[model samples]
Target: MNIDIKADDSPVTRADREVEAHLREMIAATYPDHGIIGEEHGSTGADREYVWILDPIDGTKAFITGRPLFGTLIGLLRDGRPILGVIDHPALNERWIGGLDYPTRFCGAPARTRVCATVENAILAATAPEMFVGKPAFEGLRQRVKLPVWGGDCFNYGLVASGHLDLAVEAGMAIYDYLPLVPVITAAGGVITDWRGQALGLDSGDEVLAAGDPALHQAAVAILKG
Candidate 1:
């Protein structure tokens, strides 16, 4: 399987399509009643109560470049709220999975957030600095924030959910890019939402922020809302 990157710089690869195909086939065979919405392919079986949202390769550019920042995102939504999420970074040999009954873990051990307050002391990540689109609010927020250690696609959110980063923010991401992350971060004792602090769900439009602690999240939101 081979995938072609679009003119917009969004990437595609064999792994991306293959992973989604495999997952779709498995879901169809095991849970024939459920629905699926994927990045590469579109939607199927919409009438069911359960929907599997997939971004087979969250960072296809990184994957193609061998950067190890790419990942396979799988989210199971029940009644429009994600109940199970799996982020697999095969190149990094790391996979984070969480659900109603499953514990949040890095590898096999439980993971928890560290108390990091004040933007100055916090580590941050974002997909692109230009994505803010000349919004002074976001510019002001960036200035006030602490050191931005690294940036990537959904990998940043994965780091925040795993307690390795304090926050991850992005200006214009689709539901597929944000929905799978909501449950993963929240289940790990973190907070996730749009710039206004509104709860992130399947239907949330674009913008997003994921933080490991509530106070950090509130502070970040205040900056973004400014």
Candidate 2:
């Protein structure tokens, strides 16, 4: 589980591998028929109707840099759509959990997203600006938001779900990276989707947006789509 670099130059640590393995084992033992997909390991039992997604270390770069924003993401996909999700921040002792019919919760309390109708009043977050390097969509969002903070990874989605951050835009994501955020944000009265304003599915593309308010999401999507 030692640190290693992927061909994409992203960082992966022992903690990430170990955690994913641990979660996979638990899921297999409890739900043998369910599929599993993870960042450290590849997909398994993907043909099953129910699948579990894992991103053990959503922000390895932040973790390696001694930042507490790193998070562990877990999601349960029912019929290729996310139905349950959890974002855990070990260093911060914070956790956000939600499901299709379940209310979102943060640290034992009910979680709700804030309402910011306009981009000029929104607090936006992205993992890094470099992710948007030549992407016009992201550049549009960068210019529209009132405040743009960098480097939260999955935690930024959690913050949006818990009524902290107003919006989060990310590029170059995978199923494991963003799937776990869908339920949490949606259950908190927020909206999470692809850049084209389409519903995020198992095979959705990399670009993603999470906004605390539906109007704000629509506005942001308009800017990105421009």
Candidate 3:
């Protein structure tokens, strides 16, 4: 039940530290040559050919508030490209996983994104408007969408991959925050990229846009850029 604040003013709890440490141990033991990067523990061998990105708790605020909207995010980068991701909502007993060569799966079944090929028809969600501070153009993108709900954290991306949500956009994210979402959204027949419409990678900036349909993503990116 312990909680502490990180320098970025984000909350971190005992669960976050414990989970990340355990996962890091397992990964190090099983894949000694692969790199590891974690929100809590930092990185090691990050220049290796393969790296694992970890966010032990993607929605710590939601978790501390006793909401089930939190999740553990795990992503794999092969040569700096996101090739796989897993989002696990332990409290809800739901999970989503995907990879470049595999279709997305939710709760052991194949999952896919819903089709809404344009932004005007899409439902959008972000963690919060405050997260977009100084990025006024995000408001324009919000207005273009059919609906914009806030505060789902990483769960929103999993929903997009599962066909329950259409678009998820956010800024000020770290590699662990958005990397895990890349493969899940893309393998579900959706698209995920930065505001520039380029692929997400270790070097990508914080702005992220994910859509259940590729065309819809294109429209959203254009609005975000304007």
Candidate 4:
């Protein structure tokens, strides 16, 4: 597939376009009245009570490099809140399904977050170090953690949901990027919110933080602020 760069300088490939288009078509055909927000295509009736957010390729850079870390993200919002989400790694034959009303599942088995009480004991992951460009103090938090991992994109968040990672933090993310993660993380008994510790929503900003433990979340938020 061919690749093109967007106005924001992010690369968009034909695979991204085709996948999002096909998913949008299915959503439209199945739920004609529902809204859609996609990474490749623009939004349609996004203010509706029921909306689907799609990120056809969450780790495009990794995908282009033939890394299996990329995945497709889909989230369903009801009245502006995420009710369900799915992260599917087609290459790995792995899938995670999560919802506010049910326990998270990885390949149909229950997925639960592990407990960690503080940042000092946490294994933190971020999509990239560039995410903290303007926030120097975040580097200090990174250093304070038990281990600071440097890659994984959306896969990092999924690791947090599955109890394999203690925390995932990022900034300058869009609605489609973070929205799909909310339900998955929360369903696994984790917490996801903005750096300020507020809930995530369609109107939320670019910063995101996910933690397997609430106490770790609180401590991480303070470190993020500094």
Clashing pairs in 1: none
**Candidate 2 Cα errors over 4 Å, as ranges:** none
What is the RMSD of candidate 4? Answer: 0.9
In terms of lDDT, the poorest run of 10 residues in model 2 is 136-145
Q: Candidate 3 lDDT, tens digit per residue, 1-226?
A: 8899999999999999999999999999999999999999999999999999999999999999999999999999999999999999999999999999989999999999998988778889999888889998899988888888999999899889988899999999999999989999989999999998998888889999999988888888888878
Error of 4 at 182 (Å): 0.2
Give lDDT tens digits, candidate 4, residues 1-226: 5778888788889899999999999999999999999999989999999999999999898888899999999999999999999999999999889998888999999999999998889999998878789888678788899998889988888899899999999987999999999999999999999998999998999999999999999999998777
lDDT of predicted model 4:
0.92
TM-score result, candidate 4? 0.98
Better of 1 and 4 by lDDT: 4
List of clashing residue pairs for candidate 2:
1-14
Model 3 bad stretches (over 4 Å): none
Give me the runs in candidate 4 sitting further than 4 Å from their true place: none
lDDT per residue, candidate 2, 1-226, as tens digits?
3678998899888888998999999999999999998998999988789999999989998888899999999999988989999999999999999999998999989999998999999999998878898897787778878899987889899889988899999999998999999999999999999998999988899999999999999999999998
Each candidate structure's TM-score, on Cα atoms with residue i matched to residue i, is 0.92, 0.97, 0.98, 0.98
So what's the TM-score on candidate 3? 0.98
